[model samples]
Target: MIVPLRKCLVPEFILGDGATNLANRYIKFFNPKKVLVVTDRGLKKTKLVSNVEKQLKADNISYCIYDNISPNPRDYEVMEGADVYRKEDCNVILAIGGGSPTDAAKGIGIVSTNHHHIKSFEGVDKILAPMPPLVCIPTTAGTSADISQFAIILDTELKTKLAIISKTVVPDTSLIDAETTLTMDKELTAATGIDALVHAIEAYVSTASSVITDMNALEAIKLVKQYLPLTIKSPLNLEYRNKMMLASLLAGIAFSNASLGLVHAMAHALGGLKDAPHGMCNAILLDHVIDFNFESATNKYVDIGNAFGINLDSSNPASSKALLIEALQEFKHICGIQPGLKQIGLKKADFRELAQKAYNDSCIVTNPKDAEIADIEKILEYAW
Candidate 1:
C-alpha cells in the first residue's frame, strides 16, 4: 500500500483547557521587543485580548493593539497593519480574534515584508518568502484560520475575496483558550461550529485526501458531532468548549493540506458578494454540498457516517447516502442553525450573479466533483 507522504506541521501547537499561557511562554523564544496584536473591533471588548495583554504585561512585554479590522477585513486594513508592524519594529504578531483578524495578520505579514500589492499574492504559492513570525490565539471555535496556511482579504476595489494560500501563512503557534470563546454570541457559536463540520466533511472526502488527513478529519467530525450542540446549549461548559476548540484546530490542519471542497468555494463567493457572515454562509451550504458530492464519494460517506455517529446497516450505497443526508439535516436542525440563503438576505435574483463568481473561485478546483455554473446555481437555489 502506497501511502501519500505529507508533512503535518505547526511550529508550536499549545492546546488544552487553558492553554492561552502558551502565548506568554512562547513569547520568550521569539523575544520581540514589540508585538503587534491584530484583531477586530468586536473582540476588543472581550477578555480574550485582555488576557493576552495581561500575559504580555506579566512578562514585561510591550505590544500595540490593532483592533480596527472589520468582518470582511479589507485589503487596506492589512496594509495599514503592516505599516504598524514595520514602523513599530515589532518582530512578532499576536492575532487575537477569529478568522478575519488572523487572516488579516497573515496578509499584513506577507505584503509588509515583500512590498507587493496584496492582490498580487492571490492563488497558490505567490509568496515565496517567510512572513513575520505569527502566533494565533483564536477566540472563536470555528474558522480555523489559526492552523491553516490560508488568508482571505476582501479586495475593497474589486469587491471580491482574494485568498492567499501559502505554507508561510500558517501561524507559528496556536493558543486556543476555551475561556476566550465564551464571549461569543449564540449565533456565532452555531455558525462557527457548523463551519467546523464543513471543514471535517470536506477534508474527509477531499480529492487529495490521504491517510494522515483522513485520520484528523474523521476525528474532527466525531468531536464536532458530540460537542457542537452541547456547547451551544451550555455555552460556558468548559468541557464541551475544550472539545470544540480542538476540533476547530484539528479541522483547520486537516483541510489546510487536503484542500477544501465546493462548499467553501461557493460560500466564499456568496460571502464576498453579500458581505455576510462567513461561517453562517458555510452552515447554510454545507448539507447541500455534502448531498451533491455523495454520489462521487459514497464509500467515504461510510466513514462520515461513523464520524457523525450515524448507524448505517444498509449495504446499498444509495440507502447509505439517504441515511447520511438525513443525518446531516438532523445535525443542522439539532444545532438550531438557520438554513436558507434568504435568511441571510439572499434572494433568487442574487443567484445568477453569485453563481458566476462561485464558478471562478479557486476552491472549486479541488472539489470532489466538478460543479459547473448551472450546478452552482442549482445549489444556491436549493440552499435559498
Candidate 2:
C-alpha cells in the first residue's frame, strides 16, 4: 500500500487565562516601530481592546487602532487598514477581536507588503510576498482565524466573499484566551460554536483528510458536541468557555490542513450575498450539505455521528445518515440557532447566483463529493 503526502500548517500559540497579557512580550520580539491594532467597533465597547493596549503601553510598545471593520470584512476596509498601517508607520499587526478583525488584519498585512489591492489575492497562493508580522488575540471561540492559513474578505462590488488561502497569511503568534469569550451573548456563542462544529465535520469528510487531520477533527467535534450547550446554559462559566476555545483551536488545525468542503463553500456565498452572519450561515447549511455528501463518505459521517454520541450503524448507511442529520438539526436548535436562509433575507431568485459563486469558491475543491452549481442550488433550497 502507498501513502500520500500531506502537510499541516499552524501558527505558534499560547493558550490559557492570561494569554492575551503576553501580547507585549511577543510584539517586543518583533521590535516593531509601531503596531497596527486591528479590531471591530463592537469590541471597542468592551474592555478587551483597552486591556491589551495597557499591556502594550507597559512594554513601551507604540500602537494605533483601526476599528473600521464589519462582520464580513470588506475589500475596501482591508485597503483602508493597509493605508492606516503605512500612515501609522506600523510594522506589526495585532488583531484583538473575532474573525472579522483577525481576517481584516491579515488582509491589511497582505496589501501593505505585497503592494496590491486586496481583491487580487483572492484564490490560493495568489500572494507573492510575505505579509508583515501578525499577532492575533482571538476574542471569539470560533472562526479560528488566529492560526489558520485562510482569510475571508468580502468584495463590496461583487457582494461575494473571497477565500484567500496561503501560508503567508498565517499569523506569527496566536494568543488564545477564553477570558475574552465571557463577553459574548448567547446568540454569538451559539453561532460561533456551530461554526467550529461545521469546520470539524467538513474537515473530517474532506477529500484531503489525513490521519492527523482526522484525529484533530474528531476530537474537536466531540468537544463541541459535549460542551457547546453547557456554555450556553452557563454563560459565565470559564470552564465551558475554555473547552469551546480548545475545540475551535483543534478544528482550526484540522481544516487548515485538510481544507473545508461544501458547507463552507456555500456558507461563504450566502454570507457575501446577504451580508448575513457567517457562522449563522454555516449553521443553517451544515445538515443539508451533510445530506448531500453523506453517501460519498458514509464511514466519515458515521464517525462524526459517533463523536456526537450517536451509535450509528454503518451497515445501514441510509438509516444512519438520516439519524445523524436529524440529530444535527436538533443540535442547532438546542444551541439557539433558529434562522434559515429566508429568515436572513435570501430570496429564491438568488439561489442561482449564490450557487454559481459557491461552485467557484476554493473550498468546494476539497468536498468529499464533487458538486455542480445545480447541486449547490438544491442544498440552498433544502436549507431554505
Q: Compare the candidates by lDDT and give the number of the best one.
A: 2
Q: Evaluate all candidate structures by whole-model CA lDDT and list the values in order.
A: 0.84, 0.93
- Candidate 2 structure quality by residue, lDDT tens digits, 271-338: 99999888899999999998899999999999999999999988999999999999999999899886
What is model 2's C-alpha RMSD?
A: 1.0
Model 1, span 1-384: residue lDDT tens: 888776665456777767776687887688888999899887877776788889999999999998879887888998888888889888889898888998999988998779887889988888978987898888888788988978988887766788778888988888777778887777889888988889888888888877877888898999999998899899988888889988888888788888887888888888887888888888889878877888888778888897789876436778888888888888888888776889888889988888887787777777889999899999998899
List of clashing residue pairs for candidate 2: none
lDDT of 1: 0.84
Error of 1 at 324 (Å): 1.4
For each candidate in turn, the TM-score is 0.95, 0.98
The local lDDT score (0 to 100) that residue 375 gets in candidate 1 is: 95
